[model samples]
Target chain A: MLGIDDPLIWGVYILCILSMILCVVYGLINWNRGEEAEVQEIAEEEAWEEEEEKMQSEELGL
Target chain B: MDLMILNLVILVYLLATLYLGYRGWKATKDSEGYMVAGRKTHPYIMAMSYGATFISTSAIVGFGGTAAKFGMGLLWLTFLNIFVGIFIAFVIYGKATRKMGHNLNAMTFPELLGRRFESRFIQVASGLVIFLGMPLYASVVLIGAARFLETTLAINFDLALLVYSVIIAAYVIWGGLRGVMYTDAMQGTIMFLGMAVLLFETYSRLGGVTLAHQALTNMAPLVPADLAAMGHTGWTSMPVLGSPWWWTLVSTIVLGVGIGVLAMPQLVVRFMTVKSNRELNRGVLVGGIFILMMTGVAFAVGALSNVFFLNTRGMIATAVESNVDSIIPVYINATMPEWFIYVFMLTLLAAAMSTSSSQFHTQGTAIGRDIYETLTGQKGGRSILLTRIGVSTAVIMAVILGYYLPGNVIARGTAVFFGLCAAAFLPMYTLGLFWRRTTRAGASAGLIGGTLVTVFMYLFVHKAESAPLGIAKMVLGRDVLITQMPWPVVDPMLIALPISLVLTVLVSLITRPPPERHLDLCFRGMKKG
Candidate 1:
């Protein structure tokens, strides 16, 4: 407790390092896994989106 | 000893740069290729360019000077740059931005947000903000380059300003954004090598870092009377609590730049250039490591400069001018071995030019995409050509403005560039990316409100001592009214960001929710699996 540095500083450093390691681990583990959770799924919605896209493509005539 | 030879070497560097950029002109045909290098820039080069452009002459010069004056305290900002600015930026922000960009088929920051929101109005407004704000930022960068050239080459600062701007313009006009990236890579390399070398050379010159550190510690009592009175302790020290230095470091350096990185348009657009999250993830490591080195080295050298000054002049550099910004350039020129001046010169030129080129390219695009594109309409190739012309016009305007600007050019310029980016871009950017309920009404109101308030605050409130007490003084306080506010009133970003965020959320809640389809499309449509 009476050492040359603050325990708070060392504690923050340890936490930051641990957090960084966990983040890296998560990224690697999830790399080969399937879909991202951030995205919402809609099998029905995709058909409508696809249909709209087709309509727009026809209208623009790419 | 001859300044002319140094000048000639600089000219050769300029010639080589222009030639390379013109070669790149062949690569730039469409907006995609012109803007983001066809989204295929390699991770290493992109990482270097990102690092190079981010660590400007201002960071090296101004922050170094600050380090010399303040000590190792400034190192915290560099850590933040690596962790938050680079690591978080790439993994968290970069992955999301790249995925969304590919989804929306967008080229610019404004385009990305506009496409995400399904609103051309947002794009146009964002573009307008960039056009209006980027030049001040660019000019700030230009002033930094000019100041270094002025001191080193012993020439008219105006001539240095003109020459530096022209080189940046030529490369940008010819290669577009790709050229900027190319030079940024080279500059980034030189910066890394230069900082590493400078670190070694400075340590050797000081007998060793530990010795230099002890000297600093022992010499604290010997601090210049004025600095001590002003609460400046030493390089190995910090300012007294509740002093100008403390506020400047805490609020300005840490908070100002720490949060400001997220909102910078030039940096934001960088995300759209990578291929995928894989590239982003890989590049983030490189960017983080590079930032760690670049910023770590700059502050290390800066802290040591005080020792260099005392050994040489027997006075702190700031004691000579009250402005601590000049400390780095002076210390480097004096202490480094004779042969290294050329290398140091090249190092600074690379740093300044890389940032300057990026600034010009981004500013030009802002004009083409935001202002001209809005008034005139894209209309195909005409839009492309107009955008090119806009790049040149913006560069010219910056050059002219740079030539005439007064005050401590470097400090003022950095304040302008970083300040403008903070005020005009940050608020809307953060909200646009993170705040889902962000409405167009809120977005536009935030954009205009943030920009105008920030600018008005900077010009009238910050400068009230020189100008009149524009509203803020009467409303805020007498100290602020007279430019005696002790600290800057309107960093613009701080105020704008809050207003923009609050307005965005409030308006989003009140307004009709976005079509929902676009939200689905933007947030989740990309099922790459």
Candidate 2:
């Protein structure tokens, strides 16, 4: 039987598991962030447009 | 087994690769398209191309051969491959690279550095270094690929090298980056499948994974006297903590390649091929899984090869031919099911071609566009012609080098290149991307100082394989210059990396900071220039 007590074997297993978990989490978070940024981009564009309209009306004395 | 079936398979694979090259050529309309795949490559293609290019025949054939001698302790390299090569490369360095590259309108790696520091001299010098140094690395990959053919088919080594070089060069010269990436995706798939099958087959043949490990552990007492003298205890366990074998395993192979991926010009260029950070994010899982399969399988199977060899031939791996490099090839020839041989041969070809094409493309762009065009201020048709010439020239140089390299030198040769890159380029690369205050002078010093120190150490201090014209032997009547050092076998990277890192940080602190606009352009958030 193989020695289950060997640290080298366990070290490799743990590191591989950790790497997989990190990649999964990183991918999910970044994918969601990409979506959140798109929504924020639209919101920022609307706010800019509203500010631009207010300035135009005031300039024309509307 | 019939040669006709193998020939047909080879012909079909070549034709498909050439067709992809033709497609890439048709799609190209300008220098930008040729250089960076028009910067709109899909995530799957990007990830596959990156993984394939990153894990070459060197990783498979060379490292696999090493594992046959060294055992499963080599698996730590697999973890590093995933964590550093994929995770850090894509997550940590990927975004900044894409953003800064786009901001500077830089296509080549050297060009990106040049624009960041506002120095044409930096660009030209980097290109020269890459052109000169990369061939040595590429030649090892060539040898790894051709050695498979030589062992399997009894073909002449020179002929095998020449044929593979010509086929890869044709597509690279014709299609540019697009052709290279397109074919890399296809090649990457074959490699993934081949390794997965080999892993399962090896375990099944050995009865099971646990039994294989136990058997290998039982063979500890059988370790060669020479190897045991170097502190090797067994194939399953790590060598004695401070032994020369331990140091080489930990420093040269593990740490060297683990850190070196961050700075590789060929691999780094892959980041700029995508359109958005999301593409990089998308690549993470695919790349991770691909690496886990390719390297994890290779290491496991390579180590288990001892079981198969001892069972069948009653000989240990090194005893087969007295060459560690031949062990893997001999194992496959002896034990693999006959039907899988041709398919596996294609897998090796895939691994070799994907990496060689990328190397040739990177070398070509560095010379033709980065150095020649940057120096002469040339663009358009003339620049493309020069890049084609550069690709051809790199192929010739690599082929020549492959001819002369000693047997079993593939893994050692690869370590030399990887260690050199980590020592020479990693400090500058890391600070360049993240540290805004890094000045051109500091960067230049780090580049020159780090590379020269690495070369010097390899020649004078580290005497594992080959050194610079036997300088130490002639001068000191010893193979190594520094015999009294605490860690006699510590890799050059362990010494040279610290020197490079200190020089970069010390110089940057003392020198003038970069121009404000330059800093903003490189680091300022999310504004696609």
Candidate 3:
């Protein structure tokens, strides 16, 4: 198809481009899907960070 | 090349890199920030860092040279790199890893595995493996870049090695992961642009894509007699099926590095850097395109370099340079303009630095967090300070090895690390994430057993590594334990990974499952609720 005789060679060559396009479409579709969950997760993450900090300081006898 | 012009360009680039490093240092507030960029990195930064760290100078110059010799068959590796390395990795593995790493507050790849299975032994052992094995890989990368500078700028090799190591060590030690990622993003952009231009120029010069490929295909009869004996068919075709060349291409290069990317410690930690699945989703787009441009173009241009050489020099690329490693560089010097040479130099510099920076970071964390803290039972604020010290130590070790190690080790160093990571880590890592029933005993057995098997194969069975290493020759009086044709050529990862996977599953079935409460904690928020 791309002037190469072997199907396997040209097959993978085309698959590389197709796989990249798949990534683009997947990204655009899922860009905004999990945003709300991220906000709540951030709050939990902050709490965990504070806990981690406290533990480290305690170990240091601060 | 104009020395003054090149120096000005490099000076400006280094200054910009230092500025980004300064920004990372200013932003780092705690150990978490140093380790995982505080788990709030922008999707673009995370994706670029991951891609840049994955595609090194070896991938471009080394593997690209192999493509030039072997033909377009190496494109299969590029396909696997994008589809598996980016798409499946970000979608399937990244989400699970990020959630679990957050739940466990895991800071490094080893720590992620350690906390998951509740096995300090696993963490410390994995850390030791990385600390010991990674220096060779890092040193090889260091040597590749230093050699380029030495040849291009007429600098002394020793001075180039010292200066390059010091530049990378400065930023990585001070700013940590944030510094690494920011620099990686900028470097990745340069790599993308460089490869894009090379591909465009090659195709246009060769009368577009189809004609260039057709020209190479028609030149099939010109295949050297020696290469044809080993299964060289044509530039646009796969090697003759079931031949020695086909096995090396399919088993070693394509499958070895292809599936091995899943288990690389430096790359796996990148999954933990982003905020959520949304960031990973966005990262997929950037990472896919970045890898496509980086490796896809390198492989394509590499094979097409034959066409360019034929038109200009009336000989094939291999005829021009007996050493395949020099094919890309020699081709560029012969064909590209002066300005493009400067740009390509930066591209090679960026590729080397980005990969080396990540290696140093991962090695340092392996020593500080995985080995030191786990062994000594110390988790105080001092560990981050120790990690910086570790980073410095890693840089010094790599520099020393670059000076000492023989030149031939560079090609084998990368494959050894990748094969080791796959056999040692992949089975346990994959099962630990998805199977709540995976036991600590099973994980441990897989980890240790897989490592031993891979080492044994390298020492005895794999002719490519063993013949050069010569441990088998000294001790056992054989170049390779098996002199059989295909058996000697098969990669250790192909043998060890399946054994490791079965060992994990069977042992887990026989042993007690991990605590349910811990399993719940690890798996929490992994699925979209």
The segments of candidate 3 whose C-alpha lies over 4 angstroms from its true place after superposition are A36-40, A47-62, B18-42, B154-159, B174-176, B381-389, B404-411
DockQ of 2: 0.14
In angstroms, how far off is B105's CA in candidate 1?
1.9
Candidate 1 residue B506 Cα shift, in angstroms, is 2.0
DockQ of 3: 0.45
Worst 10 contiguous positions by lDDT, candidate 3 chain B: B30-39
CA lDDT, candidate 3, residue B491? 89
Error of 1 at B111 (Å): 2.0
Task: Score candidate 1 by DockQ.
Answer: 0.07
Interface RMSD over true interface Cα atoms for each candidate:
8.6, 12.3, 4.3
Model 2 stretches with alpha carbons more than 4 Å out: A1-5, A32-62, B11-42, B180-182, B380-385, B465-468, B485-488, B526-529
TM-scores, all candidates, are: 0.80, 0.89, 0.91
Q: Pick by lDDT: which candidate is best?
A: 3
| Model 1 pairs whose backbones collide | B71-B235, B137-B417, B140-B413
- Decide which is better by TM-score, 1 or 2: 2
* First chain TM-score for all predictions: 0.47, 0.44, 0.62
RMSD of each: 6.6, 8.2, 3.5
Worst 10 residues of 2 chain B by lDDT: B30-39
Clashes of each: 3, 0, 0
